[model samples]
Target: MIAIAIKNLSYHYPDRTPALLDINLQVKRGLKTAILGMNGSGKTTLLYHLNGVIPVESGEVQVFGTPVVKERITEVRRMVGLLFDNPDNQLFSTTLRNDIAFGPRNLRLEPALVHRKVEEAMQLLSIEDLADRPPYCLSLGQKKRAAIAGLISMEPQVLVFDEPFSGLDPALGRQFRELLDELVSGGCTLVYSTHDVDLAYAWADEVVLMHSGRVLKSGPVDLLCDEKTMMRANLPVPLLGRLFQGWNEKPRTLEEALNLMGSTGLAKGKRLQA
Candidate 1:
């Protein structure tokens, strides 16, 4: 099943500045997909259309076979959860606990059910300690966690995140990644945008490369190995890609690269000690 389908999608800012042009893409159900691009590449603008955050000005966007239009926007939003790059845009409640409980409450679920969802989300995000604190008093990372907790409490089927790693420390980043894995394992579809080629290369099952509001290329993770395409998109080759530049085989993760390098003695000086 296709989780998202976008065709001939185009958008322009209020000032008439083109933000997206003739985009055509599809994300498979339950797969991890990345929108890879440089800054000002229209990554965020394209994401907004997935959940009807930005109404389609031209062409169409469909989430799980439902067209993103006013008539079906509620249904679309219910299925797809979007996490903004800046937490401030999503976290508006006076208290962190209330912010996390906002979505579940909006659904009009029983108060007990809403409370349970809030507690689960807070525990998953490790922000239970900040429950009573005002959002303004927390650090940027804490705010990001709170925002994520709020979204998770909704339990949307498709998760769309814009630069999800922006404010997370290493430990928090790893924790969030594990949570994403758990969600996907439970049959959720994941889509995220990022300018980090290395992260996309190592993490995404597929990627759509964008440049100047246009899709330069879209394909399996192997597409990142295309030096010409990466150059055209103004993105450097991923670290692993550069290391395996001329090799017949390219490994996606560090552990795989290390194994291959050890077996082939590709490392210049002594092979990585076991």
Candidate 2:
């Protein structure tokens, strides 16, 4: 199933500055897809159109085969849950529990179901201990998880994140990757935008590179390994990609990379201890 489809999509702000130009994309169901671009390259603008957060100005966007029009906007939003780059923009409830519960409750779910969803989302994100805390008082990383919990609580089929790991430390970033793995295992389609070429290279099944409000390229993760494409997109080749170039094999995680390096004696050196 195609989770999202876009054709000739273009958008501009009220001031007439173009944000997206002739963008075309199709995201498949249950894949971890990443949109890679430099800042102001239309990554967020394209994401906003996915969930109907911003109206489609000159073309069409369809979520699960339904056109994103006024009559179907509600349905589109229900199917696509978007997480902003800033957690503060999405979180507004007094308590963590309330914030996570907001989405399910707004869906008019049964009270018991809403409660269950809130609990489940918190547990999934390991934020149960933060249930009583106010979002305003939480750290940047905590608030990011809380915002994600709120979206997952709604049980949307597709989750869209704009710079989801911007404020996380290395440890939290690893945990976030684990959370995404669990989400994909549970059949959620994950679409995210990132300026981190390393993360995009390692995590995405498919990648889309945008430049100047247009898509420069879109294909499998191998697209990132293309020197010309990465240079054209102004993205550097990821460390692993550079290291493994022409090797016909790539490790997907740090542990895998370390293990591979160890087995191949790539980590050994004349000055290093055996």
Candidate 3:
């Protein structure tokens, strides 16, 4: 089923020009979709509409079959969780534990249930050790995970990340990818706005490419990364994807590509994997 649908969406900041125009998007439940664009191409604006953080200025936005309006704001918020680009902007509590528990507490769930949620989220993000420390005391990576833990405490059906892959080192990026896989395995829909064409192609089941506030392409990852579409969409071809293209292979995971490369001696004398 469609978890979120945006039809012919148009929006503009009150003091600025249009940020998005003639946009159309559909996100399926329990799947991972990436909204990809260069900076200032309305990816974040589209994410706001999906999370119901901003009112739709024109066209229509539906969350779980309900139109996002004044009355359905709470429901929309409950159905979708947004993780901001900067963790400091989102994590405000004095202690990390309290911050993670904030959302369920606000929902008035039982204390025991709230505690369970916080523990689970902390474990998922591997931030359980930072539970009692203040958010500001944590490192950049820990703070990001804590902020995400806070959002996960609410148990929203749809999870949206605004550049989750940003500022993370290779190790932390791998951790976050594992966390996303677990979330999707548990039937949560995931959407992320990003400029990392490589990560978008690697992690997203489906990709939506935006240019100048309009969709240049939207389809399964394979089709989105096709040479013609990547060129026409003005996106750099991911190295792994480019290798897949040149070899005309259907390998899915990075490990498969590694195994293939070793067997075929493709990277024997080159800096291919690195």
Q: Quick one: best lDDT, which candidate?
A: 1
> TM-score of every model?
0.95, 0.94, 0.91
Residue 195 error, candidate 1, Å: 1.4
RMSD of 1: 1.9
Model 1 scores a TM of: 0.95
| Total colliding residue pairs, candidate 1 | 0
Q: How high a TM-score does candidate 3 get?
A: 0.91
Better of 2 and 3 by lDDT: 2
**lDDT computed for candidate 2:** 0.90
Whole-model Cα lDDT per candidate?
0.92, 0.90, 0.85
Estimate, for each residue in 1-274, the C-alpha lDDT of model 1 and write its tens digit.
8999999999999999999999999999998999988899999999998999899999999998999999998899899999999988998888999999889999899999999999999999999899999998999899989988998999999999999988899899888989998999899999999888888898888999999999999989889989999999988889999988888988888899988977876663463543
RMSD in order of candidates: 1.9, 1.7, 2.8
Cα lDDT of model 3 by residue, 55-156, tens digit = 889999987898988888888888889988888888888899999999999889999999999999999888888899999998888898888888988988
State model 1's lDDT.
0.92
Error of 3 at 256 (Å): 1.2
